[model samples]
Target: MSVKPGAADTSAAVTTASWLPLIVVVLTQIQASFAVNALTVSMAGITTDLDTPATSVGTAITAGTFAMAAFILLGAKIGARYGTRLVFQIAVAIHGLAMAAVALSQSPAMLFVAQAASGAVIALIAPALTVFIATNFSGDQQAKAIGYLAAAIPAAGVLALLIAGSFATTIGWRYSFALVVALAVVNLVLSFRVKPVPPQKDITIDWAGAAIAAVAVILLSFGFSGLNSWGVILATDAAPFSVIGVSPAAILIVLGTICAQGFFQWTRSRKAQNKPQLFNLDVLKTGAERATTICMATMMFVGTAANFLIPLYMQIIQGRSSLQTSFSIIPYTLSIFIASTVVARLYKTYSPRLIARAGFVVVAAGLILLAFTIRGDWHQIFVVIGLITLGLGQGAIVALVFNTLLTAAPKELAGDVGAWRGLVHNMSGSVGIAVASVFAVGILGTLVSSQLIDNPTIPASLKVESGINLDQVNFVPNDQLVVTLENTSATQAQIDEAIRINTEARLRALRTSLLVLAGLSLLAIIPAGRMPNEVPALEEPQPTKGKK
Candidate 1:
């Protein structure tokens, strides 16, 4: 296969490009997104059908994200060796097959397998996509192309929600994944129209660096994921084992940080030897690039955390249906799509640091507003307003940071940008969901005891007699909660009072969690200001041979 002509001429490539290939790349993003989002709407269905706990579904999500994050760098190297377009096509095919498997999954274990398979395929797609875009377009055209793809990402999630809502009612949740397969097939056919991208035979995978990066990211993700089940500070009863009653989650994070440092050292050594690096360490050498990277991860973390928390509160706590969850999120998702599509026009009008700092402010403001407005009813207008604010900010940040990183490096290092982005995105998303979920749960547990102690309806004698375990507090629907109270020796008035206490505590926990996240978002403004103030030069700024 031959690479299309004038691939090195970014400006010329943009002027002469066809839109079909770009559309194909965007479709690939939608395909992968559909697979990732299938579980969000089907959480209750899967948990019920497989007779498994909710944690099992979270485990599947984590497994998939972890697999993708761990293997992405190697996937980029492989893509370079074999040709990006070919690797992308093959990955799409595998992703389709994985989606089909998910459709027929009969157990939680099988579901995890399906998710992991899809995840591994997604790792390859990242690098391939980066190379494809780099080879095809540049300058403002590249920014617009990336913006459209980013917009499509949320559209995919919206589509997944609708598919699940429609099919889960008529047939079952299994049909939801079947829709993912259908999209993947359409995308696969369109991808063949993309021009050939040839292999970079000189590039090779570094197995040692790969191992270190993989293990480090996996451990960091695992640590975060464990917080909900294994306890935040100490080993909970769910934990299989512990070291001095300390949380295994904490231990893993410490180990992961050390490994990350080792990875950097190894990359430096590889560079000094004149070997190509797994990640483009050259790009990361600057303070601006590093800040941009952190801001990118932080933006994703907020979005992921908010998404997880919202769906959970609606579907699990309020006992609302999947369709209700979809409807509730419509404003936010739509706002994001609109913002992502339109914000590319602002590139020339504003500096990156200014745009990024403003984005963080908008997001933080949204979080605070939401914190103050949440009620048992999940009010429509206020929630919509708050989410729209958050979405507008999120969309701008994602688009700007993406263009910034890609522009900072040479076109040939597009795969490097892609691989690192995949790692950061998946890792941050997993950690965000895990941290928010467990942190809220921990806060709820603490508040439940205090609430029971303060409630006038529950006398000290009744607290001992009812045998209610405040330490094991968790959010459940009112109906399930009634069943739980039935097992305890309590009068009707006392039961109602206890349920009210639990509900109030849960609401309080949500508020507190949002405030914490908002504070974190506010903290990010400092680094957002450190991002490069202008677009980088198009000329190759990488180190020359033997420079290290």
Candidate 2:
């Protein structure tokens, strides 16, 4: 591979350096992971403390994720223009301050602001990690480093579940964010030891492309995340505004998709003009690269949807405590951690196409198993096995696709590749949770409305008298439902019937949603088959005139 003229030569230093830089990179990954996971594990406490609905927390998560996806392309360019090491240090410090804000948050709005700030900074850190690895490691060592970086996500999740769960249950949710602040500080202090590459003065930030990308991502993120609350196609009462009676969510999605096409067209124009592009389109020029992106997005969609559904089922439907929910998820998180760390060993023995195809198959089977085996009980052995199976597949694909992208791209384009990967992960994850919620709640609403009409116990007259709107139905615990009915003229028998209907509808909705995800997983096998038959060799750097 031809290296740009101004690119630093650190091959000799990289080969002789110790693993300290990798350690710093891994810690940085962990800090970001911990912030998100801690919020997830402490959902109950957050809702209670802030006196807000669960959807508010979901909004906060989406805001942060959307912010990251929106700005990551620009972030990659920023790292190249301003030294990656310096940018990384600043981002880490800012992230720590954001965590502190989260710890001190007095309301849901404060939490959202803090999390969004953290995510924007993470855009800088995410690309830098990949650049660091590409700059500091080579050959097998680089492969191993990517694997470790991938594993850190689930590993941090495990730690968050254990530590945050305990804190939320025993003390307060604020402690978890406090812990993240401390980790950020440690990462900052250790970052000074990492090798630094000189900034590329020739690279120019593409402000127009960045604006298009940011607007497109923001629209798509809000559109998907608001499907349930705002209405899939029609405007709901909860929708802040609408377009000619159509939901803003639907309109936003269409606009966002159009803007996305505009972004690509803009990039092409910039390339034609011989100007610095927002990202190197060549990073995704090949069929294999496109396929890898699809596979990565699909894996994240399935994993994140399952992750959202499981916790909702345990905590909301079953009324399990936060700590108990964390315990139930332990097997799944641990499986991911173990699989991510070890899957690198399989690259030499098996083709990536084969492994990726098998991984998707396993993921589909796991979802199907969970869909069928889930009962009122969350402690069933089959449930545990299903979770583990899903995690293993997700972990393997996560590491596999990332390593493939990095190895295939020239080192000069490493930051672009990383930015693309981060964009996929965040955008897909947000869409996954949104789609899952829409499916589960929409299905539940339909089933409940139909059951109310069919069940002899729930009279049509009662339904009319109760003033309940079928279209606006939401998933609530039985106890909460009972409390709601207490205000009405509902008799004991009517209330019991409503609870029974809710119980059955929730389970059926979950099963149907899982089946839908399983079908999506099976479809992903098409792209998985298109991945490189074997891992691609890293390109050796050769000097050339600087051309971004």
The local distance difference test score of each candidate is 0.82, 0.89
Q: Which stretches of candidate 2 lie over 4 Å from their true place?
A: 1-17, 42-60, 105-112, 169-172, 486-493, 539-548
Over 221-257, each residue of candidate 2 has an lDDT whose tens digit, in order, gives 8899789889999999999999899998999999999
Write the residue-wise lDDT of candidate 1 on 1-548 in tens digits: 11122233343222345678788888888888877777867887888889999889888987888889999988988898888888888999999899888888888899899999898889999888878878777666777887887788899888888887667666888888887788788888888888878898988789899999999998888888888888778888888678999989888888898899999999999899988778769667789889999999999998899888877778866778767878888889988898888877776666778888998899888888888888877775787798899899888888878878888777777888889888888888888988899888889989888877767877877766656667767777777777866777778998888778777887788889888888988899999989887655443223344644
Candidate 1 deviant stretches above 4 angstroms: 1-16, 43-58, 106-109, 454-456, 537-548
* Candidate 2, number of clashes: 0
Assess the local accuracy of residue 486 in candidate 2 as a C-alpha lDDT between 0 and 100.
78
Candidate 2 is scored at a TM of 0.91
